[model samples]
Target: MLDKRRNSNSKERIDLINRFIGLFGKQVIQSVAADREFVGKNRLAFLNRNEIRYYIRIRNNFKVFLPQKNKEIKASHLFNCFKTNQFVYYNKIVRINEQLCYLSGCKLNSKNIKQDFLIIVSFNKPENAQEEYQKRWQIEMYFKAMKSSVFDIEKTYLQDIQRIEKLILLVMIAFILCYKIGIYLHQINPITIKKHGRKAEVFLNMG
Candidate 1:
């Protein structure tokens, strides 16, 4: 998933995903959650074709066809149609690039007019989609910890990509060890995180 060449376009993204699948096999992956930048019609189709459950964040301006309402509308417009703090969902087939696929949207939290500021498109029910998408944040946090919070990976003087990747691997191993130690400490002390206002990972790493 590391590419310095900036081959991050939709085609390259799909190719990388397929390559991972080829290496690990489909059973290794259960579901996927990605940011809006990694989502498009073709990419969704690729995930769908492989029967991988995915929840992808969509831009507010992303177009979706609502057959129930018999109209095309932007994702933001759909949000405005709902009341604040209300749980709502729409299940329909959305057309993208002449291809039609199932689209589901769920509102996680609500604003004054738009109930769902963070909209997710998925094949699963909207009720659970946001919860699943939240899992992706763990990966984001891990990367953040590696880059600056703990490892400061960006400060590396090495220019070689291979060496950089190896350094990242070492960092990952160290992170895993720290997390395991953290888990063990948590199990022994059983401290409630709400009281200390410090994350278990941070507290454990400090130990």
Candidate 2:
């Protein structure tokens, strides 16, 4: 757990993760995916230097230097003519923070118009970025289940960093167990798909 006073940016989080995994010298990470909060020039450069594959989403207005164009352009500008739900994968890679990366962009047909653009920068397989980024939503759903529906963790109102870490660790343990049980339960009897296009709830609730 990070101290409350410490202001952690993408670099710090990535460094922390790298350090943790460094203990296992031969560990191999398939790829890393993160929201815009973790997207920055230094962070991207660091990942590139380490040859770490990544799919980091960026805001529509993020500027990248296009070598072909010999200028910086907002991500959305490259796909300005794209229709809703239309995805564009640039043939040539671009430079952001002087790090070479590919870009895959989409104009999502979501209710929130302002945030419709889903732009992802990656070290490879830009065409697969949009779909890969969708999996992050599943992680968000799990956190929501812990913080509200299932564990109600927010009510604890933790302040001390050590106490918060302990609480989060316990919650994480429960979450892992419940998620595993949920998977097993689903294998026995599939979950019912509700009208909202998702299973009624995590199968753990059925257990």
Candidate 3:
């Protein structure tokens, strides 16, 4: 039950939701919201199972699960308990600080604990997460190379949508050609080039 919030009023956004629904089916609930904070601040959904609860928080003191008992409990109560405990029991240890944990029971000739433990810890530096996120620049680099180096997309004179699309397709074809040629050259015999002498030979002949 991972929840994702989107501005659903726009036709583009609605179409995106429809695409997901077509693949995953109607059981995927659709909720319209003005902004991400609305979904985070308001607990508009419920935990269907007692075994586990999943939620996201926006405002500082947001409340979550209610006590099944007649006595009412606020979200702060659960947060306080979790903060104090510093751990949640999932029949065994499940979550530690920021890391997820796993424990194995004894049996089947195995040791008391297995090697499946996972620990997640966050850095205290303000820019650590941002730096990690910035590592995605490789994707942007690929796009830039495709549009400029491989496709010469900026050189295209067409303004019509269909012609622009055809130019994009041609650019993709050029990239594929370059990639295949690179792979083929990499698989050629290096020994044959070495015997041909340094002046005439390609330095990176691969085989």
- Best-fitting candidate, scored by lDDT: 2
Total clashes for model 3: 2
All candidates' lDDT scores? Answer: 0.71, 0.81, 0.36
For residues 1-207, what per-residue lDDT tens digits would candidate 1 score against the true structure?
Answer: 455565477788788778888999889876788987888767877877777877788877788777667787787666566664454556566654444554445445644674446767775555677678889998887887787677787888988778888988998999988778777887997756666696544532332
Tell me each candidate's TM-score.
0.81, 0.87, 0.30
**Where in model 1 is the C-alpha error above 4 Å?**
1-7, 83-87, 96-116, 195-207
Q: Arrange candidates by TM-score, highest first: which order?
A: 2, 1, 3
Q: What 10-residue stretch in candidate 1 is worst by lDDT?
A: 198-207
RMSD (CA, angstroms), candidate 1: 3.4
Clashing pairs in 2: none
Q: lDDT winner between 2 and 3, please give it.
A: 2
lDDT-based ranking, best first?
2, 1, 3
Candidate 1 lDDT at 190 equals 74
**TM-score of the candidate numbered 3?**
0.30
| Superior by lDDT: candidate 1 or candidate 3 | 1
Of 1 and 2, the candidate ranking higher by lDDT: 2
What is the C-alpha lDDT profile of model 3 across 81-153, one tens digit per residue?
3332233322322221222222111112225563221111111221232233234454454476665544446
